[model samples]
Target: MPANRAFVLNSRPSRETPAGPHNFRYVESDIGEPGDGQVLVRHHYLSLDPYMRGRMNDAKSYAQPQPLGEVMVGGTVGEVVASRNPRFAVGDHVVGSGGWQLYSLSDGRGLRKIEGGTPMQAWLGPVGMPGVTAWYGVNKIIAPQAGETVVVSAATGAVGSVVGQLAKLAGAKAVGIAGGAAKCEFAVKELGYDICVDHSDADFGDRLKAALPDGINGIFENVGGKPFEQAMLWLNPFARIALCGLVASGYDGTPTPLPDVRVLLNTRSRMEGFIVSDHMALWPQALGELAGHVAAGRIRWRETVAQGLEAAPQAFFAMLKGGNFGKQLVKLVE
Candidate 1:
């Protein structure tokens, strides 16, 4: 029997402190065989996302807190190495919540088989949760019309990149807000954004206003601090805002209060906060459209891959701090 190497939650992180190595402990345990109706998956890639930071806390959230002495929860794309279930077979690739481990044992629940049309890692990224999140936000919450201006923060990231591209496909001007100069350039040149603003710049607000002469018709809010505040100043009448994430204060306890939330009221704008899992009914339709776009080369994506299972912890924190570009993943297998 082979040993399974995994990272377990050693302790819960405080709201004030960022999660680190102290929060987790690596464990090597003997792999056990499946009983009946079970499958063993060897993880090829593990996704590192910002939402994991909120799960580290012991506070009440939409989801349960990550349990201590258990494997850290994450998205994984892997192949079935062993199967005792009729639903799953050996050599079948799958995507599921397999946590931060080299392998996962499951009873075939919550596992979706991969059909090999897209790259394996893409299933964990652009064609997966992140892509679906953007789809739901753009298609449902901040529904944009032609000739409108749509903006997305964290523009070079997994969800934000899709939001910008989808807005463009809707015939709206896609304006992206990213952290550094390089990211801003990539958002415009590589991702086909109309204008890319550098939120890290000293005159960020000035540049943001200058870029939008027609005001913002819709916004996909990923970072909530300065970017959200600045976007408020340009809200068009009856504009819509999709509150996707707040990576700005996910680690720290403080959530920067909007300079004036009345902006929503003032412009009669709508701001909706959504969790993609809550809308499972929309997924098949969403993934179908996204897969088509990706397959046809209309929707492009990028990845920041960390090497080995051990790098998962480091990569997770780095991604939360905007140290990574696009979707961050750890390659657990060659």
Candidate 2:
């Protein structure tokens, strides 16, 4: 048996944000060989996402609270070092919910084998959950028509970036709202957005309104605060909003004050919140399409990778505050 290092939730956050490093306790324990029907995997990359913040709370929500003293939940891309199951073999690469650990033991449930054509890290970002989330929200929910305008907040983020790109692929004008000037530049120059507004600017609302003179027909709402409220002001008739995330308020668990619903009623606009997991039926289709886009280089993605497993907490905290660009990940192995 070899020692496996893991991060466990030691205390609940008093607020919506992570309680700090003191709340996560690192422990090393002996990992036995895989039992019959199980596989032992060595994690290479650990995903850091905003949604994990909500799971730390004791409050009621779509998913249950993360139990105290248990390994923190997260997505991981790893290699099977040993396998007792016929379905998986040594040296196989897999994607699964492997938690915050150096290694994991699984029975192949919810595990998907990944091909080697693309970077393994891509399996956690563009061609994985975030990409599928964007695909479903854009193609299925918003369904923007050509020449329409679609606005997305957190535009440089994993999901938001893909949302903008997908909108452009559909011949729609994609507008982005991001935190700083650099991200705004990347959104327009690299992601092919028509325009990107810097939320940090004092005149952000004015800028957003100017960019979409034709009004917004669809919205991929990622940050649900004033940016969302501002987007509401420019809704075209029959506008659709795919409420993918609320990273703005997720950290503090604060209630987001919404704009008046009278506008929505007058415009007959639609706004719906979605959990990607709830739409399991669409995963295969979404992932397949996303994979093709990524493989052909039609989709460009960036990563802010922390070097080691020990760096996961800081990397995760920075991601919550918009400190990282693109997808946030922890590279656990060389």
Candidate 3:
């Protein structure tokens, strides 16, 4: 039997921001065989996300803290090599909360068997959590009308990219805000956004204003801080803002200060924050539409894959720093 490689949370960060390699320690262990109702899964891909940063802390949050000495929590798509459970068979593909490890044993709770023409990795990306997240924010929250303008921060990321495309599908003009010139180009050219403003530019506010001349009717906000503050300046009357994430404050585990409430009051705008899991009733509808768009080549996605289980720690840190483009995942096995 081969040993299972797992990245465990060895130490908690002393500060709120900047998670470093010292926080995680990789270890090899013998997981043995699955129990009577369990399945042995070998991870093929692990999803790295901004939310995991919050889990690393001991502070209270929507989700429980990641336990020290346990495998770092994450979503994984993998193959069932052995199964004692009747629900899952050997060689079946599954997506679940498998954590950061080469192998995991599951009793089938929260595990979903996936089989499709789409690549398995897509189950962890655009057609998975990120896609559904974008759908909920755009369709349920923002609800932009045709000919309206919608601005999305972190435009090149998994969620933001999908938000832009969904806005276009709704007949709205999509404007994106990204950190660099290359990412801005990708958002506009590849993702079909009407315009993309580089947040790192000296005149980013001016550029965003120019791109949205009619004022922003909707905003799918992912990155907060200065970018979010700038977007608030262009809100039209009765505008909608879906607050998805604050990646700017994610690293430090700091609370993102709310932008001036006066703007919301003056514009009669609606801004709401959401957790995608809270809307589980809509998953089937969201996934079906996202899958259709992906299969028909209507929705475009990109990935920054790091090979092997050992690479999970560095990959996670890199993702937090915005080093990866699009969806960031760790390829645990071939």
Candidate 4:
């Protein structure tokens, strides 16, 4: 059998994902032959997101949870090494749900042939799901107006970074709330947010309140623990909050405490939570616009690439802990 390496989730993660050697097992397996209309591809880049942590459990959600003893669910960009489908040929680059493995076989389902105008890894980051999520959150959910103050937590991450920049492009004053000085600097300096507050600062709440004295018109929420609680105080009447992910409590078994609804009622504001899957029908238009922005140099992105497939599990856990600088991509092979 031709051998291939894969990252397998041994068990559901608790508060923190245990090391790969403990919670994840790497093993060599047969490189199963491609069936009719299928292609055998070798992975180059794998996109890691916090939502994957929620999928690790068997619990029901918007999408089917990853089943135990199965290869972990992820999006990958790969080059076709063998093809049985006429639509794809050997040496073609494709992006699809290829999982975390050195080799993947796909039957053309949900696969897109990629071009070389930009880096192939981009299909897994900006101009992909993360970028699509930001577009949906801003245009459909928040709808920030010119002069409105828009804030995004986890601001330097793939999704949040796009959210903030899109808000700026729409003429809204964007403020990002990130984890530390470095992330905050990136958000303000590189991504070009109006201001960025570090959530780790002892006076973070005060700083946020001071930054938005007239109140926030829209908030693209990514981190939902203390930041969500504090953002509530600054929301303008009829303000909209686009709740994306709750990375702060996603990995744990403990129930995430719901934020007080009284604030919503008292301020007459709206808070709506969403996943990208809910807006699938709009993906083509959204991705087209995002791709245009990326190609036009309007949207800036940064990626931290890990060296190999063996690095995915460790890189994923590190990302969950806010250790990654930007979009984390694991390179499976050359």
By lDDT, who's the top model here?
Answer: 2
Give the runs in model 2 whose Cα sits over 4 Å from its true position.
15-18
In model 4, which regions exceed 4 Å deviation? Answer: 14-21
**lDDT per residue, candidate 1, 229-324, as tens digits?**
998899999999999899986445565676687888899998898999999998899989999999998899889999999898888888888999
lDDT of 4 by residue, 31-88 (tens): 8888899899888889999988778766777788777677888999999998999999
lDDT of each candidate versus the true structure: 0.91, 0.92, 0.91, 0.87
In model 1, where do residues sit more than 4 Å from their true spots? 15-17
Going through the candidates in the order shown, the clash numbers are 0, 1, 2, 0
lDDT value, candidate 4, whole model: 0.87
lDDT ranking of the models: 2, 1, 3, 4
User: In model 4, which residue pairs have backbone atoms overlapping below 3 Å?
Assistant: none
| TM-scores for all predictions | 0.98, 0.98, 0.97, 0.96
**For model 4, the run of ten residues with the poorest summed lDDT:** 13-22
Give, for candidate 3, the lowest lDDT window spanning 10 residues.
13-22
Model 3 misplacement above 4 A: 16-18
Cα lDDT tens digits, model 2, 134-211, are: 999999889999999999999999998899999999999999999999999999999999999999999988988899
